[model samples]
Target: MSKSEALGAVREVRLSGGTIRYRERGDGPPVVFVHGVLVNGDIWRNVVPVVADAGFRCITPDWPLGGHEVPVPEADLTPPGVAGMIGDFLERLDLRDVTLVANDTGGALTQIFVASQPERVSQVVLTPSDCFDRFFPPMFAYLSAIGRMPGAIWLLAQTIRVRALHRLPNVLGFAAKHGVPAEVVKSYAASLQRNRAIRADLGRFLRGVDKRHTLAAANKLAAFDRPVLLAWAEEDKLFPMELPRRLAAILPDATIETVGDSYTFVPEDQPRWLAERVVEFVRKHATT
Candidate 1:
C-alpha cells in the first residue's frame, strides 16, 4: 500500500514524552508491533493486513527510534527513554491484554517495557533482534561508534540518500536476505534527511544502547509466566540464530519458531509466514 493509503488509517495520540502515530486494523484482540531503528511502522505493512484478516487487531506505531513524523527532544530519546514512550503509548490508548510484537532494536525496547511495566501486555512475539551482548550486532556495531561522533549521523543521512548506498551491507543490507525495495529504504532515510531532530534522536539512541538493558530484562523475563513466541529469521546475517533457542530457555513459557527464507526483517521477506504464525499464536493465547 502507498503512504497515502497508510495515512488514511493512521491515528495519533500524545504520551509522556511526545506523540506516536499508529495504524490500527481489525477489531479483535490487540497485537502491537514495534520496529527497530531507522524504519517506522511501515515495516509491518505486509504482515499486518494478513493477520488483521485473521480476526485480530494490529497496531503498528511509528516509534521515536527513527522514522517518526515528529521527533521528541533529546530529553526523551535514550533507549530506555523511548521504551518508556512505548509504555506510555500503551497506557494512553488504554489497551490491555496486548500481544507485544517486536523486531530488531524494538525487541530490546519491548523487553525494557515489559520488565518495567507489563500490566498491559499479555503475551510477546519477539522476532530477530539485538540480544544479550550483541546490542548492535558486529556488522552494525560501527553505528553505535559513529553515533558518538559529532557529525557522523548527518553524514550517514547524506550517504544513504543515494539509492545504491541504501542497500549496502552497512545500511539495510543485513536486514533481509534479498534486497529491500529502494522506495521502502527511501522512506526510512527520508526521516533522517529532512528532520535533524530525528537524526539527533537516532544518534543518541545508538550511543546510549547498552546490553545491560536486555541483560537486566533477561532475569525479569524468567518471572513472566505468560506465553512468549521467539520467531527468528533463519537467513539473518547479523542476529545470531542461536539466541532464539537461548531466549526460549530463559523465558518461563517461550517457544521457538524459525522463519525460513528471510533475515532480520522477516516481515519484508516472509510476511505471509509471519502473519500466519502471529494469528495462530494469538488465537491460542487470546484472553478475550
Candidate 2:
C-alpha cells in the first residue's frame, strides 16, 4: 500500500482494459464506491473514511468517467461498456457480498450492473442519480449534441477551462448545492485538460446517454432481490426526488431514505449522513 497523504493507502488494480487507482480503509464487509462524469474517486474523499471507520472496508475507484489519470485506450466507454468494466473490476477483486454505494452517474451505472450482474452486490445505496427520462437531463443535453460534432470533446474541454464555468447552474451547479472547492473543481477537469484521448473517452460516454439505458436497467430490476436503499436528496432539482420512489417501487426489496441539504452528490454535501446510512445498511445486512 502506498501512502496517500491524508487519506489511507492507495493501490492499483490492473484489469483487462487498464489500471484502476483506488483507496481503501478498514477491513470488513466491502463497500465499493463509484462516481459520475468529470470527477474521480476523490468525490468520495469525505465519505469513504467515515464509512471505513465504521468497520466496513471502503473501496473507492477512480473510474474512467473523465477525471482518471490514464484513459483506457481502445476501451469502449459507452454506458453499457462502463458497466461491464465495473463488473470486471468486481470479479477481479473477488469481493463478495459487496455494499455498492454510488452517487450521480455512478448510481445510474450501479442500476445497470445490479440488474445484469446481481451476485457481486449484497446491497446498494443510491443518492440522487439519473433515472429513466432524466438521463443527462435537459441541462446536459447540449453535451451529447456537441459530442456528436467534430472535435466535440476538445470543444467541451475548452469550455470547461473557464474556471468559473464550474459553478454555473448548468455545469456543476445541479450536482452540488454549495460552492465546490477550487481544488476539487480543478481535479474534476484535470484529466480532460492533460489528455485529449481521455476527453474523447468522456465524450463517448456522454454522447451515449439516453433514457433507454436506465429504462432497460429498470426493467431488469426485479431480478436483483437484494436490499437497496434509495437515499435521494430531497433538495435535488436536477434529478427529481420522485425518481428514487420509482426505483424503490420496482426493486423486490427496497426502501426510500430522504436526505436533506444535499443535491445529486450526497457524498459531497452530506458525507456523514451518507456514511451513517451505509453503516446502518451494512450492520443490518451483516455481509460478514
Candidate 3:
C-alpha cells in the first residue's frame, strides 16, 4: 500500500490533558512513533508504512510539543508531567506490550515515561535524541531562554515562514540532512504559528525542559531491564554517538546500531533503514 493509504485515517482519544490526534495502520504488535518539538507524526510518514506492512500496528501521534492541532490548556506541561501524559495515553488506549519509537525531544520524554511506567511497554527503539545533560543540546538551548520571554514564542513561530530559514542550524538544518519537504515543514509549523493556545502549550513545555528530568530517568534506567534498541545516526550533529553509548552502558539490555548517511532525523533521511531495523529488533525480541 502507498504511504497515505497505509496510514489510513486520523483518529482521536480523549485524555486528562484533552484530546490527542493520531494515526494507525496494520495489525499485530503495537509500535507507536513519538516526534520532537515543532513536528508531528508526519515526520514518520515514510517509516510508518514499512513498519506497519511488517505486520505490526503502527501508531503515530501528533504530540502536543508544538505541532499539534489540539491544545491541552489545563494539562501539566512539565518534563515529568508530559511523561505522565505519555503514560496516560498508553493506558487510555489500553495498549500493552507496546514498542515505543522516539526521536528528538520525544526520546527524552520516552526515557522518563519508561522509567516511571514500564508496566505496559515491552521494549523501545530510540533514535537520535536528548539524554543526560544534552537535553536541548547546545545549539537549541536558546529555546529555553526564548520560552522564558512573553512574546518570544510568537516571534519564533513567525520565523518558520521563511523557507530559507528552515536550513539554518537553529531551524531544521541539523535535524534532517537532506532538508525537510516544504509541505512537511508547513505541517510542523502551522499550529504553532497560527494558534495562540498551541503556542501557549509549546511555551509551557519548552520552559519546563531541564536536564534534571533526563538525569533522574537515567538513574532509574538500570532497573528498566527491558530490551532497548538505540538506532543512532552516525553523522548526527545534534545528538552524537556518545549519548547513545552512555545509554548503552546504563540500560542492562541495550544495543546500538549506527545509521549511516543521516543526521538526527533518521526517519526523514533513512526511513527504510530505520523501518528495517525496527522490524528486526521487534521481531528478535518478540515475547511468546
Candidate 4:
C-alpha cells in the first residue's frame, strides 16, 4: 500500500488564518504529532497507525508550508508568526489537555508553546530540535552560514536534492540504524525537494531564531512545571544527543528517554517503539 494509504484516513481542517492538514483516529484523549523541519505531517504515517490502534485520537497536522502545499500568508509564516499560528490552531479547535509529540523543528516549537502557554499543554515528548543559539553538531554553522550568503539558497536549490541526502547513512546515522524505508525517505525528500511552501517556511523559521528567543526558551524550560519527555536519538547526525541531555537538565520536570537507533526522524526509524513509548508517557503524565 502507498504511504498515504498506510495512513488509513485523513481530513483537512482550516483555521481562521491558516490551514491544518491532520488525520484523526483512535478512541481516547488527543495526541498530536508535530514533525521536524522541511517535513510535512505525513512523516508520521508509519507511526500514527500504531498510535491510533493504541486507543488515542492521533492528530497529526501538516504544518503550515511544511506539507500539503498549504498557503501561509507571508506575515503569519514567520517564526514568531508560525508560533502564534500554532497557538491559534489549538485555541481555535479548543484542543485542551493535549499531548504534543514533536521532533526536530517541531520539537523546538513545542518548547516555545509550553513556555508561552503552559496551561494549554498537558504532556510533551521531543526528539532532536534546536534549543540554544548554535546549531546542533556544530556542523550546521557552516550550512546556516551558507544558507545566509547572497544567492546561497538558490545555489543550494540548484545543487542539492534534499531527498537524496536522506539516504546517506553518514548524513543521519540513526536513520540508517533503524532502517528507514525507501518510500518514507522518498516522501520526505519529495516534500523538501519540490515544495515551495516549505522553502518559504524554512527561511522564516531559521531567521526567526534570534539570540533572545533561544535564551528565553532555554530559561523557560528550566522553570516549566509540566511533565516533559526528552527522547534523544544517539545516532542523530544533525542534533547530537548532548542537546537533549542539556534539555533534560533544564526542564524542571523532565525525564530523558534515549533511543539509540534513530535519527531526528524518530518515527521513520522506530515507529512502533516510539509510538508505544509516547502512548505510555502520555497515559502516565497527562493528568499532571
Of models 1 and 4, which has the larger lDDT?
1
Best candidate according to lDDT: 3
lDDT by residue for model 4 over 239-283, one digit each (tens)?
776777888888878888878767777877777878888888987
Better of 1 and 3 by TM-score: 3
- Tell me the whole-model lDDT of each prediction, alpha carbons only: 0.81, 0.82, 0.91, 0.67
How much does each candidate deviate from the true structure in C-alpha RMSD? Answer: 1.9, 2.1, 2.0, 3.2
* Model 2 TM-score on a 0 to 1 scale: 0.94
TM-score of every candidate relative to the true structure = 0.95, 0.94, 0.97, 0.84
Tens-digit lDDT track of model 3 for 1-288: 112444557889998988888888889999988888888888899899899888999988888898999999988999898888889999999999999999999999999999989999999999999999998899999999988999999999899999989999889999999999988888888888889999999999999999999999999999999999999999999998999999999999999999789999999999999999999999999943
RMSD of 2: 2.1
Clash pairs for candidate 2: none
The order by descending lDDT is 3, 2, 1, 4
Q: Order of candidates by TM-score, top first? A: 3, 1, 2, 4
Tell me the spans in candidate 4 whose CA falls farther than 4 Å from its real position: 1-3, 65-68, 135-137, 142-165, 168-179, 189-198, 286-288
- Candidate 2's residue-wise lDDT over 1-288, tens digit each? 112242367888888878777877888889998788778877788887788887878888888888887778777688888888889899999999898988888888989888898888889988888878777778877877877888877766677778788778888887898757877767777778779878877878888878899999999998899999998889987888679888878899898988788888888888889889989987987733
- Report lDDT (Cα) of residue 172, candidate 1: 73
